[model samples]
Target: MGCSNNWCELYGSHTSLCGCFVAIVLHGNKYITNHKGQTKPTVLLDCLAQWGIEKIFCIIVDNATANTCALRKFQSSFSLLSNEAFVMDGEFMHIRCAAHITNLIVNDGLAEVDENVSTIRNAVGYVRSSTPRLRSFELWIDSGKLTRGNFPLDVKTRWNSTYLMLSKALEFRLAFDKMEAEDMLYNDYFMEFEGGAQDGGRGHDCYNPEESDGVE
Candidate 1:
């Protein structure tokens, strides 16, 4: 179970091949009014009833306070019914999402290098801002004797995208330096980021290959 922007997404997973392979299926989605613990359990129960699903081995949810409350309520309600509804009387019914846990840890570690990551993110955004700028950047890459590849922009919510963005950008580090030296637009592009209100007055230098090491 996961709620984002007042929408709750429920997924169902079952073990196949005698508990060897796990198959995940999307059960349903509902537009939630809020993230209240009470609301979530009720919504899940309603979905289960609609699906005619009575027995569930476990429920995996992200680490959230509301999920804790929802699990407690769900378990209590299930306990009222027959014990066959759970594999072990709901002893191991609540499972925390491992991917979410890892994402949380990675995001925490990346916080220390947030500014450095932001610089590269903004640099990529600059080049991708328009077709003309992209052409100029490609020219720089060609002149610098660097192989050109698609520069993937990172999605802030996913740390893996940031890693890809930085790794790919490193290939064209020399090209960025070349742009800073030769392209006036490229040089001025970063000036707006320096001491800007949006960035909380954190001054940024023009993207430098040397600074890429900080993020690495």
Candidate 2:
């Protein structure tokens, strides 16, 4: 852990315990492959020694198994102290950093309609299947009878951003419905869900601009 004149900090990087695949590199981040049972702490120890770090103050970890495994390995092997927040130390121990805890919560628990969600997601993929369809969607939007909501494509966007998908596709109800009538998803479950979703009588930010999105 490192320390500022007025504060102390600890730091370590951890990824998803579920292993969905990600490679993030912060200024001091070192890549490590972690698995269950054996060999990781030794490898991590070697890496730290190579980097000339003798002590770790905290290990920032999240829902991924590999990350959880790695953090435990580090804690057992070394004599580092435990703290839940960031500390300016050589290596600190902190589990479930703010962003990661939120991710874990979302991944583990969120009330949503799954089937309708998939229908909306696949629509974009379906559109990409044919350039003509894509072009038609574009044209539909240009005709002023449709509005496009944000379609987030980030990794975290997969399951968590269904609302965004609904808002986007649902906004252009006429265009989407017209397209639906002529194609594969004519009787889509999402169409029904969209039609009966939260009433828009009053302003609500369930789907809104400039709000922090949720993902698990």
Candidate 3:
């Protein structure tokens, strides 16, 4: 029986704690269940014990305080059982979630390139905010004879969305450059708002049309 605590907001109002349970094994069918309660160590242990899963070999969970405490208490109980059903010493039962670790690593690396990412994100937002700007961008694409593709806007909170936005924006770098040079409204908008309080004074100097071809 593997369990983990997940906190979620209901209807964007009330916050609730939920415990996710999963039966994992090398063979046979597996099932998952969810229980809502306090994420204390004793509560989690009681939930597992009620499921008749006493001979647990190991518990895989993220490196949370409650989970670590639960596992420490659970190890003592498992040691008391005389039957040799449990494998290993249960000392190294808790395994940190790999996906969480990878997210941490990727987010850390993203911090180094945040300024460049923000520049691209803001440029995309600028073009997408108005119908005339979007139309102007489409016209630039046609003028350049470039294959048309949708320009995806990204959610700031999600790193993968930012990556996709940058990837898609790179394909239309020429179009963006052309629009910046030829479209009067586009230039005026940037001059007025690019370094203003609305955009936190992030200037358009970072997105030079001349350097668009070499932007990474």
Score candidate 1 by lDDT. 0.64
Give the residue spans of candidate 3 off by over 4 A: 1-51, 57-86, 130-135, 142-150, 155-157, 188-216
TM-score of each: 0.72, 0.54, 0.55
Q: Candidate 2, which segments miss by more than 4 Å at Cα? A: 1-34, 37-39, 80-92, 108-111, 143-164, 182-216
Clashes of each: 0, 30, 0
Ten-residue region with minimum lDDT total, candidate 3: 25-34
Using TM-score as the measure, what is the rank order of every candidate, best first? 1, 3, 2
Q: Model 3: how far is 183 from its true place, Å? A: 3.5
TM-score for candidate 3: 0.55
1-216 in candidate 1: lDDT tens per residue?
233312223345432100101112223454345667777667666656665666666677777787889779977886666667776666777877777788788889888877877877888887877777887888877644222247788888788887788877776778777877888876666666455534421113434556556456
Cα lDDT tens digits for candidate 3, 1-216? 233443332434322223333332211222332222233444544554554444444455654565566656656665675454244554445666565566566667777767777776777787888766677677866544222246678776556666678767776677777776787765666456544544442224355556544334
By TM-score, the best candidate is 1
Local distance difference test, each candidate: 0.64, 0.45, 0.55
Q: In candidate 3, how many clashes are counted?
A: 0
In model 3, the Cα lDDT at residue 101 comes to 66
Q: Name the weakest run of 10 consecutive residues (lDDT summed) in model 1.
A: 15-24
Model 2 C-alpha lDDT per residue in residues 55-148, reported as the tens digit of each score: 5554444456666676566666654433432235424354545565665566444435333344445565545555565666666565442223
Off by over 4 Å in 1: 1-33, 142-149, 193-216
